[model samples]
Target: MDMSSISRHEFRLEFLVTSLLFTAFCGYGLVWIEELVISEHWPLDEQRFWPGKSYDLNGYLDIIVAGKEHPQYGRPNILSLRYLDEVARINQYIVHNITVPVDLEGKHYEVAYTDLCMSFDWACYLNDHLTMLMPKSRWGNFSGPIAEFASDIINNEVNITYPIGWRGSEPIYFGALVGRPHLVDREGHFDHATALRLTYNVGNISYIWRKKLASWLTNKEKPPSGESQMLSETAAGEGQAHCCLV
Candidate 1:
C-alpha cells in the first residue's frame, strides 16, 4: 500500500479505539452517579431495620438509640424526633429523684438548650433547603411517592395525640451554662454550651451527630459498663467534637 493510504488506515483505527474508550468511560460515570443518587434517596432492602423486628433496644441503657448502619454509606433509614412532653417528664423525674452534686451548687445549671435549639434550627433549614429541590403541589406541599413514604413514616413514629399548650414561638437563646458532663467522661467537665460555641462555625451539626451515632454503634459491646462500651462512647463523642471543630 502507498504511504498516504497506510496513514489514513492507521488514523481511522486510532479514532475508532478512542471513541470506544470514551463511550465506555461516559457510561461508567453515569452508572456511578445513578447508584449514588439511589442510595441517598432509597434504603436498601437488607438494611431496612424496624425497631421491634430487626433490632431490639432493650439491651441498651440510653434513652436515645441509633439505627443500623447504611449498606451504601449514604443516609440511614432512621427518623429522629425529640418528644417535648416526654423529655420534660424525664427531666422532671430526674430533678425530683436525683440529688444535686455539691460542686455544681449555686450555678445556673440548665439543659443544653443552645445545642437543642441549634439542632432544631438546622433540621428546619435542611427541610426547607431540600424541599426546594423537590416537586411541590399547588398547596405548597411536597408531592410524590417519596413524600408520601416520608409522611407515613413520620405519622407512624410520632405520637400526635399529645396535648399542645404553647402557640407562640420563642427566640433562640445561645449561651454557656453549667450542664451535664460528657457521656464518656464522668469526671471530665465538658458542657454542651462550650461544645456548641466551639463548633458553631464548623461543618453541619447533623452530619457530626450521625458520625457520632455510627461510632457509638460500632464500638458498643455486651455489658454496657464494659471497657468497650466506654471506648465506643468516647470514640463517638470525639468524632463529633473533631468533625464539628474541623
Candidate 2:
C-alpha cells in the first residue's frame, strides 16, 4: 500500500477508536456523578446528611433524610434541619411560597420553596424540564427533571416505593410529594456516570474520570430548554419512564 493511503487508513482507525473511548468515558462519568446529583438519589442522601452533620440527626434520621436542605422558599435563607420535627419549622419558613393550590397550569409557579436554592445544576434541570414537559402537555404529553428524579426513585423495576403506580407518572402530577415531608424518595446507583458525582462524593475529578463519567451524567438531565419528550414513553399513560434509552 502507498504510504499516504496507509497513513489515511491508520488515522481513520485511530479516530474511530478514540471516539469510542471518549464516548465510554463520557458515559461512565454520567452514571457515577451527574445522575446522583440531578437524578434520583443525591437529595435523599443529602437529606440524611444534613440532619447528621453534628449530634442532631442521630435518632431523627438513621436511614434517610440526610443533608436535606430546608431552604426557605422565595427567600435565600435555609432553615437547615436536624430533626423530623423541624418539618413544622421548615414549613413556617418556606411552605407558603410553594404552589398553594398545587396546579401546573399556564401560570409560572414560584421557583418552589425548597427549589429556590437549587444548585446551578438543579436550576438548569427545572428550567429545561418545565419548558419540555409543560409545553408538551398541550400535545397531551408531559415530562421534566423532577419527573425524572421521581421515576428513578419509584419506577416499578427499581421498586423504591410500594405499589406500581404510587407516585404517579411525572413530577408535576406529584409535585405535592416535594411538600409532603414524609415521602421517602431515594435510590443508590453508582455505575459510571452517577459515579462521576459519586466520585466527588468519593473524591476524584480528574479529566480522565470526568471524561468517562460525562456520558452517565448527561442522561441525568437534557441540555436545558428543548421541547422533546427526552424519553420515548407515550404521554399520559406511560407515567414515568425509567433509566436510559441505551
RMSD of 1: 19.8
Candidate 1 is scored at a TM of: 0.22
> In candidate 1, which residue ranges exceed 4 Å CA deviation?
2-9, 32-203, 207-224, 227-246
Tens-place lDDT per residue, model 2, 195-226, is 00000110111222222223322334651112
**Which regions of candidate 2 deviate over 4 angstroms?**
39-42, 45-246
Clash totals in order: 0, 48
The candidate that wins on lDDT is 1
| lDDT, model 1 | 0.31
User: For residues 1-246, could you state the per-residue lDDT of candidate 1 as single tens digits?
Assistant: 699988888789789999999999999999988877765654332224221122211111122212233467532222112222222333233223322222246665333212222222243111121121122231155558777866664444322111111112321222121112132243232222111111211122333433433443344343211221222333333223321110
Clashing pairs in 1: none
- Please list the C-alpha lDDT of all candidates, in the order they appear: 0.31, 0.28
lDDT for residue 124 in candidate 1, whole number 0-100: 12
